[model samples]
Target: MNKFAALCLILCAAPANAHPHIFINAGLVFVVDADNRLTHVQVTWEYDELYSLLVTEDMGIDADYDGVLSEADTARLTGFDMQWIEGYNGDLVGTLAGQNLTLSAPTAPTATLTEGKIVTTHLRAVSGAPQINGTLSFLPYDGTYYTAYDVTLPVLVQGGNGCEVTVDTPDIKGALSMTKAEIGALPEDFDMEAAGLGDIGRRFATDVRVTCAAL
Candidate 1:
């Protein structure tokens, strides 16, 4: 099956109690134009050691098993994750003033092996170049909760004056309580396939908010 179809099956089969198999430390750099318009965002994903090992092994790279990549290996690994399937939002959601912002396809992909982990980055252009006045929010999450993302790295604003960036973590206790309540409300015979639990990750997502001084 194709990537999109496979993702559909994974989402359908995922239960409310499903835990993430892959973990990522994510970072974002908001790029603003001189006119104070939000133009692009550079996203970074650092994969965990286990996942990094798996990827290297699967690709038959890193022959020395030293957890370091050669130049050729880095070249081959670049854009490996950029082959995104249609209908996938790259696990990134952005909103400004309560309106969803359209993001262009990933570009300028780069990959490297650092300290036994895989680090990758790509840029996504904001389609309309919206003015940066009010608050802008972003969340990185996998709908099925199969891959967990944490804003553990630097969240920066580049080329924008008087802009402040902050990370607001979700209330884990409250989110867990709500999830339990929803699962408990389901009837004994309720079909798990119809549970619509794919969005459980959003409840625990870390919010990345940006606010710019009135411009």
Candidate 2:
């Protein structure tokens, strides 16, 4: 498989059920410098228990059924190559001042099983420091609809002077309806790749808008 396909398999493999195979409750922490310029974003994803079990079993972790995957287990699992595909626009999208913000490669990726759930965290640095004068919008989703993203926490802004943040979550129902309608309008034999299925999910994703007050 190609690099993009391999990465998609881990995160966006479509099942026959017409619904997402994995469900993720996600949260974001926006890291800013003292000058109120965005620096990095910390993302946390919590997976459902069923998916967690599948991941543990597939990765050959929790060998003794001890409920906890060892440090080695965590390391091995985290070692999966998740680097951004060069031509692929990643699942996470961000914009500031209506201009797209480039998110660099992910760092400090960690995965752990806790309370029957798998939680992972990764930090991605913004390519450049962009001051958030008004609103910063984010959408996280797998375009194939193979994975669903639901924001579980407010957007946290850390280390920005005089910056207060408010998170506005989009309506899931409305977004879902929009995606379904768009997909349904396609021809029965429509080619997914040609139709850009890999970029469709964002249209239905719940937006995470971080609006800040004047500094």
Candidate 2: tens digits of C-alpha lDDT, residues 77-158: 6735365678555578899978999987788998877887878888889987888887788888877666788887556888
Candidate 2 residue runs with Cα over 4 Å from true position: 1-18, 81-84, 178-182, 191-198
lDDT of 1 at 152: 97
Supply the global lDDT for candidate 2. Answer: 0.73
Clashes (candidate 2): 0
Best by TM-score: 1
**CA lDDT for candidate 1:** 0.83
Compared to the true structure, candidate 1 yields what TM-score?
A: 0.86
Q: What is the TM-score of each candidate against the true structure?
A: 0.86, 0.80
Q: RMSD per prediction, one decimal?
A: 4.3, 4.8
Q: Report the error of model 2 at residue 154, Å.
A: 4.9
